[model samples]
Target: MRRITVPIALLALLGSAVPAAAAQAAPPPSIAWTACDPAEEVPEGVLCATLEVPVDWSRPGGPTIELALAKRPATDPSRRIGSLLINPGGPGGSGVDFAYFSGSAFSPAVTDRFDIVGFDPRGQARSHVVNCDSDLIGAQYTQLYPDNRAEYADLRATNRALALSCRELSGPLVTYVDTASVARDMDAIRAGLGEKRISYYGVSYGTMIGQQYAELFPSRIRALALDSNMDHAQNIAGYQKWESLAMEGSFRQFTSWCDRTEACALHERGALAYFDELYARAEAGELNPDGQPLPPEDLVNIVFGYMYNPNSWFELADTLLYLGQGDGGQTGRGEPVPNGYLPVMCSDFHFDVGAYPVLRAIEQAQNRLAPHTRLNPLAWSDLASCQNWPWKVTNPPHRLRASAELPPILLANSRWDVATPYEWGTSLASQLPSARFLTYDGVGHGTYWRSDCARAAIDTYLVELRTPAKGTHCPAVFPSSPVSAQAVPTVVDPLPQLTGPFRR
Candidate 1:
């Protein structure tokens, strides 16, 4: 997961509209591939290219932007099917990085048959990035949990300032980074590759992109594998209740693991109770050994970040134990503000927080629903960050209208996913005309990475156009031995580190 610093500033800057370039008839794009940049350290066989597309699809002959693309060619070209476009779900996540670094995460069955192509969606990563003043972005973090109307108003002003800064610095592209635009960009990529149809593998936020693509161009997709699905039909209330419930469920899973596993640092001491004590200390302004104050939100974020993967539960236990003993360590510091998170989210979903009373009521409801974790930090952050966003909701929440002719889409989700809830996968499945939902009875955000059964199902669907039977469920898989301090698994997925809530 990419971690970016968001610093808040009070400067005001006026944004200018993008100037239209020379008018030309819209034509199918083509790529001129070259060797991967040495600095990127992409695997030996990967090639890189860029596709130039219009900033606004409505004005096909308008200002243009270049999207970064990376491809790992199929190892066995004799059996190669086609390009399998992959996305690792940070609205801000780098597809180029995922393709470069985590291509090995795919099963050999997939790797041997399809070229793994990853692209940084418009305004993400190597694409024309959306940037704002760091100080302006950082200021909003302090108001994530406002106490009164005055604080809430301050939060709104800060959010407005951040949006204005992004507009001024990033230009018109800031207004067009919604998932719908990215979905259109995906088709442009397909056209550039000269492919009649493209298969897709999207996780977390990427699932939203995949869904929008399938909706807009159903006939253009050969297959789609969406893991840890996003429900585009949710309103603000649905986001709050379901996201918080999912986090709470994951927290319960962790506590249950501690109860049965002797290797858990807090097994002897009650894990939930110890976490409560830490939260109390944080709220009371207790300083860690390093003398930095651990705010309650920071403490919650630390735990939420670790909850993405079961293997990281051991690290989380150790970190909490250290914090309890007055050792601040690395995890004590709060996550940096999420840059480029608000624009896409605010543009895509309408968050009608309304007046402070309404916001306060929402907070109270979240607290009641999730007393243990307080709330999903990512969910609350998304709500708070979009308070005074300058952009309009270009793609607001609604039930998906997928084409009946669309190929069968494969959806997977863990039973206890902390980010995208399992209900979202099922909900999305119901929305699509032809979709099969695969349940991973496990405890992680991305089911494909955690369950071999999920990976096999997805691979078969992508390579052979075979869907798993309806209501397919993969049994949970846990480490044979309890996780010890020295045995904590390395987290390869970057979604957890990204600040946005839906990042898988």
Candidate 2:
């Protein structure tokens, strides 16, 4: 692995200007719809298209990248209101895949009234993806949690190497994958589709894009629905605190469920104590149900992934029970490879832990905030991975500047979302005075698919332009047992399919 060093002068150039393509007076060229490639696996009626957007929005005539798009035409074209753009929320999530596979997730009323459109944001799937060396990414020294100064240096070195590889393989687009750029691409999409305004459904990280778009093009939004929101106003400490707090809260909810639910495999053994024992075994390098040892970080990541949905609690309980009983049959699950989306995260938020001392302090605070979970795997990963990322912070965290003329945007989040957290939604609602917040008293990353009440509220808001009543709350729904939980089809829940650093 070769260590690549970038000059401080180049870093300054990268961060010099925030792209403002949405403010450009010139209109984008219209898209020409065509059939999707057979490999895309789109449904029968779905149409595919590509729109040309500047790799560096500030230099519109310099270089352009193609943004992939998918659209499911309205079921009833006669009553079509407009296009409803949907994004499934990884900083790397494939909106095109969401449009093809999860179109059924929306209500018939919504489907009948609007064309469901999804675009793979720049440097994401179908679009020009950020590429990096896999071996460097998977290197043992690339661990996110560094204990000492030497290990911290190795982590930073590895991150810089990965960034260099991405730049080398991906070209200039890698330096411009910020959410603000994506938001500008969205406005371009709206223009290309020839619609005066477009309705939007953005979840998790996608909410950040939607929020920025609203700030840039407030008058051009027909309706906006932000689910599992990202609070773009947090500093380093605030970001870690809220994320770790949410992860810890979800773990507690799982333990509480195990205590009362007779169907939970770990109910008799005690969920928390059993999990703690597993953690101890992992740390001791003895927790090997299959032949390979499970590292403590991997153990925590497994738990973190399961916490994304309440329906997966039973599966999580069973997995832990199997591990406790030394059942190799349930082990040996392979982790997803890195998709090189860190630049998007690195650019959108500032997570610079200047030195190991600052990093140690942040870890201490997180541990105190989330003793059982220790730290949020995703949140900590973002903070640690961006320590020495070569890309400049193009769209750093700041107060949201939503327009007063903006319509009432609908916001929804689960009370126990391990990924996005409930307070993020409320925090955003406070920032956008016209926005209405909807709370689902549940455990999950997203509210729309998990709760019918939430879905109804969102659909009504999107289709009828009527916001949910102030202080509206949706009841949580839980499956009876592990077997019954498996009955919930995977297609209905589209977010978990997204694979990357920020799986939200």
| Tens digit of per-residue lDDT, candidate 2, span 342-370 | 88989989998788999999999998988
Stretches of candidate 2 exceeding 4 Å from the true structure: 1-28, 140-142, 327-338, 488-491, 500-502
How far is each candidate from the true structure, as Cα RMSD in Å?
7.7, 6.4
| Model 2 pairs in collision | none
- Please give the TM-score that candidate 2 achieves against the real structure: 0.91
Worst 10 residues of 2 by lDDT: 1-10
The C-alpha lDDT values of all candidates are 0.80, 0.83
Model 1 CA deviation exceeding 4 Å by range:
1-27, 287-289, 327-338, 480-502
Q: What is candidate 1's lDDT per residue for 32-110, written digit by digit as tens?
A: 7899888766788899998777687666556888899999899999989998998988789888877776455777788
Error of 2 at 356 (Å): 0.3
